[model samples]
Target: MLKFQEESLRQSVNGALALRHQINPFLDAIFEKGITNICFLGIGGTYASAMQTVSHMKEFTSMEVFAENAAEYITTGNRRIMDGTLLIYSSVTGSTPEIVKAVEKAHAAHATILAFLDNPNPHLRELCELCISYPQNEQLKLFMAADRILFLRHEFDCYDDCYENFDCYLADALISVEQSSDSFAQEFAKKHCNDTLHYFVGAGNQWGSTYSYGMCYWEEMHWMATKTVSSGEFFHGTLEIISRDTPVTLFISEDASRPLSLRVAAFLPKICANYTIIDAADYPLIGIKPQYRGFISHLVTHAVTNRIDVHLEAINCHPMEIRRYYRCLEY
Candidate 1:
C-alpha cells in the first residue's frame, strides 16, 4: 500500500462490476441481430489488454474474434468488421484521438458498437449504438463485458455458476493483489531500481500482461527500454540476447500455459542470473475457485503489476503520471 488507495481501488472494482449490468442490454441487442464476428479495438494499453481478452474468447468459444490496434485498423481495415460484427471499443479517457477515429470508422461500417468509456464523451458515445461508462479499471470492464457476451451466447460454459459468485471472487482477487503490493512488488522494485532495458515474457492468456506491462508500464509510463516476448516465441529468437546481467522477468499463470511459462522460468535462471518470476500461484486468491483461476489470472497479474509500477515510481523518483510524448506533444 505504498502508493495505493484501498478505498479508491474498491470503488473502481465496484464500477467494473456495475459494467456487467450496463453491458447486458447491449449483448441482448447484438444477439438479436445475430452477431457474426467480434472485434475488440482500443489504443495503447487498452489494445494490449484486448489481445489477452481476445485470446481467452478464442480459446473457449467458436466465435470469430479479433483484437486490433485502433490506429492500425484505420489504415489496414478489417473486412470482418462489417454489418453483423459486434465491435467493442475501450478508452479509459474517452478522448484518445485514435480511439475516437476508430469508433467513427467502425460505426460507419455498420457494425454494432458497444463501447466502454471511462469518461463521458458525447461525440464518441453518439457513434456507438450502446455505451457503458466506468470510472477506472478499463481492462477488467472490457474483459467482463466480453465474458458477458460469451456467456449470453452460451460460448463461455463457466459463466452461469461462476458469475453467481463473481462479487466474492472479484473482492478476493483485489484483496489478494493488495496483500502482495507490499511484499513482492516493493521488494522487487527496491532490488531492481537501477536496471534498464528489461525483458518480459508470458504465455497463453497471461501473454497480454507481458505485453501491457512492457509496453504500457515499463516503456510508456516509466520511460524505460523493455521488450515483451510471447513465451512460445521466446526460444525461437529472443533467448539469443540473454546475459547474466540481463533483467529478465517471467509472468506465470495457473492456466494450461502455466507449463509453458514454467519452461521459460526454468531456462532463464540457468543462463541468466538476474531473472525474476511473478506467478499467480504465489498469491492467495481467497474467493476465487481453483477451477476458475485461469479466467481471472490476467486481472490478478495486472493488479500486481500496478503495485510494481507504483513502487518503481517511488524508487525512480518519477511519478507514473509524467509523460514526455503521450498527450504532452503531438505525434
Candidate 2:
C-alpha cells in the first residue's frame, strides 16, 4: 500500500469498462465497410501490449491480425498494410514521432486508422479516423476491441457475457489481486534490489507482460539491466547462462502455452537457487469465467508486477519517474 490509490485505481478501471459502449459501436461502423486484415502498431510498452493482443486474437479467429513496432514499421513497410487494412494504435502522449509518421503512411495506403489515447491531443485526434480517450487500461481496451471484432465476425459467442462480468467484477478483482500479491512483490523487491542482472521468462499471453516489465519497467524506469525471453525459447540459448546465483523470474499464465512455463519451472529448481514464479492461476479472479481467464491473464500478471515496481522504487530510494536521458535528451 505504499503508493496505492484505491479510489483512483477503481475510477480508472471503471472508466475503461465504460468505453465498451463506444468501442463496440465504433468497431461496428468500421466493420460495415469491410476490412480484410487488422494491424496493431505502437512503440515500446505499447508494442509489447500489442504482442499480447495479437496473440490472443489469433487463438479464436482466422482473421489476418498482426502487430508491428511503429519505429520498425515506418522503416520497413509491411505489405499487409493496404487499402482494406484496419490499423489500431495506442499512446499515452499521442505525439510519438515514429507513430505519427507510421500513421501518415497507413493513411496514405487507405487503411482505416483508430487510436486509443490516454491523454488528449488534437493533432493525433485529427490524424486518426477515430480516437477514444480513456484514463488508462490500454490493454483492457485493446481486448475489448478485439473481442468486439470477434463477436461481429461470429467467432466469439460469449463476448456479451464475458464483458458483463468485466464491467461488474473486474475492478474489484484487480484490486484484490494487488492487495494479495503485494507481500510477494515486497519480498521479491527487497531480495533483488541490488542484483546486477535479472532474467525474466514468460510464455503465451503473459510473454508481453514479462517483456514490458523487464524492458519498460526495470530497464527504463528503474535503470536496471535485464533480459527478457519467452519460456518456450529459454532452453534454446538463454538457459545456458543460468546458475545458482543468477536471478530469474518466470511468469505463468492459464493459456494454452502454460505448459511451456511449466517446463521451465521444472528445470529451474535443479540448477538455479534464485528463481521466482508468478503464476496467474495462483490468484483468484472472483467473477471472471474460467474460459475467459486466458484472455485477461496478462492483466493479472501486470497487476502483480505493479506492486513489485512500487516496492523496488521504495527499497532502492530511486523514484520510478526519474530519468537520465529518456525524455530529457534528443536521441
Which prediction has the highest TM-score against the true structure?
Answer: 2
Estimate candidate 1's RMSD in Å. 1.4
* Model 2: pairs clashing at backbone N, Cα or C within 3 Å: none
Query: For candidate 2, what is the lDDT?
Result: 0.90
Model 1 lDDT per residue over 11-33, tens place = 77866776677788768777886
Which residue pairs collide in model 1, if any?
none
Residue-pair clashes per prediction, in order, are 0, 0
- Model 2 worst lDDT run, 10 consecutive residues: 120-129
Measured with C-alpha atoms, the lDDT of residue 261 in candidate 1 is 88
**Candidate 1 Cα lDDT to native:** 0.82
